[model samples]
Every structure is written in C-alpha cells, then in structure tokens.
Target: MEKFPQMGGELHKIFGSPESPFKTVSDNILQYTCGKRAECIELRRKLLEPKDAHLAKLLTGIPPSSTALFEERLLAEFVRAHPSTVRPKPRNPPRLPPPASVQPFPSTQPRRERDPALQVQEHKGSWHYCFPIQAQGHQEQPLTQQ
Candidate 1:
C-alpha cells in the first residue's frame, strides 16, 4: 500500500475530516511527515524548533530565543524542587596543633656513673689497682674509697 495515502486515510479516520478541531496539530504532523521526505525534514525542523532552542540553551550559557514550553516546565520543576549537585563538595580539614599540656618524651636509656678502680695501671705488667694501706699494731688494713 502507498505509505502516505494509507497514513492520511488512517489519520483522517482517527482525527476526523480536515475541518475537525485537531486541524492545526494533525495538519502540522501530516506536513512534517508527508511529501518527498526532504520537504518533511524542513517541516520537522520547524515543528521541533523549540526542542532545538532548548538544546542550544543547554549547550551554551545563552538562550538563542525566548523560553520554550519545555524549558518553562523544566525551570518551574527546578524552582519547586531543591536541586543539588550529584556529589557533595570535597572536604579538606586543617592540621591541628597538639595540646599545651602534652610534654616532651624522656630519654630512652639512663646514664651510668664511672668506676675509678677500672682506670688503667700501666706500671705493673699485670693490671692491678692499689688502695692505701693502714698501719695497725699487728695487722695491715686496706683503705677503701669513701
């Protein structure tokens, strides 16, 4: 069957004769669909011009023409709803200083006292440390370091 002829018959049947209340819409739709198809492309461009204008506003920050019905509805919805970003802003906290009450760490190892007896005695080939001898009546006592 011939496509457009069948489509017109079907549209006419569905919408009624050409003089019906749906004239403009059905006529524009038929014009957008009819003819050598090249003409149909032009008609389609004209009919959906608002969609293209909305897309232009989306692409560039500027709107090429006055607000279209689609844009009006979308912006109205946005006004009604609380639109937020898909993801929240990133958080970067600052490094904090330590409290004044915190004190410094103590030394890891304790210091030891020196032993004087451990000093080297070179004169005697055998190493020995001598203490003063105390004179007693019959015995001698070694005086130790106080």
Candidate 2:
C-alpha cells in the first residue's frame, strides 16, 4: 500500500477536482508554515542570547518570512535586539554659548554677587565682555574700545 497525502490533499480530493483550490490552499499553508517557522527560529535565537556575529551568519540564508504579515514580528524582534539604551549619542553635544566673536551691548546693570548658600554658575556671557569681540554676521568693530 502507498502512503497518501493528507489534510490539504484529502480536502482537495473531497472538493471535486484538486487543481485550483488545492494550489491556493497549499500556497497559503506553505506561506503560513514558512513564516511561523522563521518566527520560531528568530525567537529561539533571541531567547538563547546568541552572539551578534553568529546571528548575522544565520540570517544570511533565511528569506524574509512574509513581507506583510511578518513586519510587526520583525520590528518587535529588531526592537528587542537593539534596545533603546544602546543608541548612539547625539552628534552635536548641547550647543555651548556662541564664541567670543560676538559681544552683548554694554549695560550699567550691577553684577550679581555669589551668595554663600547659592551654587556658583559659570558665567558663559563673561567671554564676550572680557574680550572686545566683533558681532556675528556683522562687520562692525568691537563695541568696547581696546
């Protein structure tokens, strides 16, 4: 006796001829199985805490599961793999005050004295006044005479 195909194949036999519907159902099942298997493999790899190089090598042969259905899973896997804390630092550190090439207009405002209880903040603005600096985007000479 020969072994016969079951499930989808048997269903195909029961439903008139097995040409069109069988093809469609078989394709659908194949796609589903492939996607599920890929997801399982990926999840197992992630849970196992494999090294990056090993994971990268494993990924080379595997085809994308299903462009539409597997996207969320892929994204979740990516997020799980990367983690937000390991993100690169911002290219620009917080902008420091503009260089001494620009100066603020002179005012008779009395300088505030440091209180013993208060924390001393570095006066970034002092650089402009301390040096007779030229205004940025302006060709005008320094406001204070040297």
Candidate 3:
C-alpha cells in the first residue's frame, strides 16, 4: 500500500512535534548546561548571523536564518542536547538581599543541644558505663550511686 503524504504530515504533528526543551532536559542542570535564560537569549541573538554556515548546519541540521523563530528553535534544540552528557545538578537559588534594618536585640535564648549519651563503647575489657558529654552551664546529676 502506498503511504499518503497527508498521513506523514499528521504523524509529524501528533508524535514528531518537538517536545519542550525545558521538559526534554532535566530542570536540575538546565541552567548550568544552557546558562541563564538571558544568556541563552543573547547567544541566540548572536547565532542569527551564522558566522560559520557549516557549523550551524552541523549543529541543527538546518540552514541558519535571521528569523527570531528560527533562532529560538535552534537554541532550544541546542540546549536540550547539550546537557545529556552531564549528570543533572540541583539549581542554585537566587541570592536574596540582607535585611535593611538590624534588630536592636540579638537572640538570647540558649539553643538546645542534642543528647550526648553514647549507645555503646568498649573500654579495655568492660562493655558498659559509656560516658556522656557534659552539657554547658549544667552540673552532672547522679542517676544512681555506685
């Protein structure tokens, strides 16, 4: 049976359509692999001129064009493919500004320390009486007299 050209177009629309590069590539390493969005935009802007026609063709399998849509698509594909080789890393959070006004009083409450008791320790021959670390500003209370 002869395949219809219309069917081919339909297939491309349904299954072969380009997936969103954001989803295609892992979000964890997207920034590191592709750089910030502004940087990608700038790089796409530079790619419009096609300084090397051969390189552009080799990268995207399409001829370079000055059109904005072409540039965006090229960059999207480039970003999607570039990060696959490296494992994804967690995204770095944006730096926030420090508080404008300093508080008059600092925190005065003492922080609670974790339990300093040891579970098990072998000292020479005995296998018991594990010593616990002394907490600050507190005296050791006798649990029981030996």
Candidate 4:
C-alpha cells in the first residue's frame, strides 16, 4: 500500500543523502531485514522511548501522558507522518555571460519625476499617495497627512 512507499521514501532519501551507506532503497531494506542490523535495531529501540512516544501521541491525537497507546499509535503515526515520495527539485542552468559586442549604458542622470508635488510613500506594506484632489466646485484639497 501507500505505507510501504512512504517508509521507503524517507529511507531512499536518506540513502541518497549523506546519512546512509546504502545506495538504493532495496539495498537498505534487504540489509536491515536480513541480518542483525545494529542501526535498524537501535532506531527501533529509540522509537519506544519517551520522546518518540510523545511524538506518536501528538501525531495520533492521543493524550501525551497515556502510555497504553504508545505501540499502536507509534506505528500508525510514523507511517502517516512522512510523505510517500519526495522528488528532488530541478536545478536551474547557469546563465551565460553577455556578448562583448553589447555595450553597457554609462548614463548617470537621476530619474525625473513626472509630478514633483505628488510624492508616493509606502507605509506598513501599503502605498500612500500625497497629492491634491479637486472636488466639484471645491478648492484643491491636499490629502490628509497620515
């Protein structure tokens, strides 16, 4: 079922990563299941400890202090916790340098504002406009200063 792949996914990821000596999922599983695997035995032993028991309880929505639910909860929770597969992200190719024929612009002039009086400012992630408004038959009213 999905559980097999999910457990395999974490194991497979760790194998490819710096954590495990095995190169593939099948190799890791075969080694663990076949002999008296020290690593596998140690990991299984740790799962019965208080810390892992707490995690199991949290994942299974059982009260943390309840010791009776540890074994069943741990097995169910651990499988459900990890995803079935985690595909590596695709890396972007390096950008090529611009051709020698293309020349860089040497202009150093400051950008000119179309309207000098109408200043715009950002406040608390929102843009505020400081400009005058002219209502019908009313004098030009400057925006209220925030």
Ranking by lDDT: 4, 3, 2, 1
Candidate 2 has a TM-score of 0.24
Per-residue alpha-carbon lDDT of candidate 1 for residues 67-98, written as tens digits (9 for 90 to 100): 34334555445435523312344597675756
Rank all candidate structures by their TM-score, best first, as comma-separated numbers: 2, 3, 4, 1
Model 3: per-residue lDDT, tens digit, 16-77?
Answer: 55664544455558766656655665676455534456544545453335454345676567
Clashing pairs in 1: none
Best by TM-score: 2
Candidate 2 C-alpha lDDT tens digits along 18-133: 46686778879999998988777677645434356655554333444444323456546655875742346699889866555564534334577755532323253231222223
TM-score of each: 0.15, 0.24, 0.19, 0.17
Alpha carbon lDDT of each predicted model: 0.48, 0.52, 0.53, 0.53
* Residues 1-146 of candidate 4: C-alpha lDDT, one tens digit per residue: 47476877787676776556565666768887756554554465455434445544544453233234335665556547643322345698687856656645433345765897566676555666655553444443344464
**Residue pairs with clashing backbones, model 3:** none
Report residue 20 deviation for candidate 1 (angstroms). Answer: 1.5
* RMSD value for candidate 4: 22.8
Q: Model 3 segments beyond 4 Å from truth? A: 1-70, 84-101, 104-146
Model 3 Cα shift for residue 134 (angstroms): 36
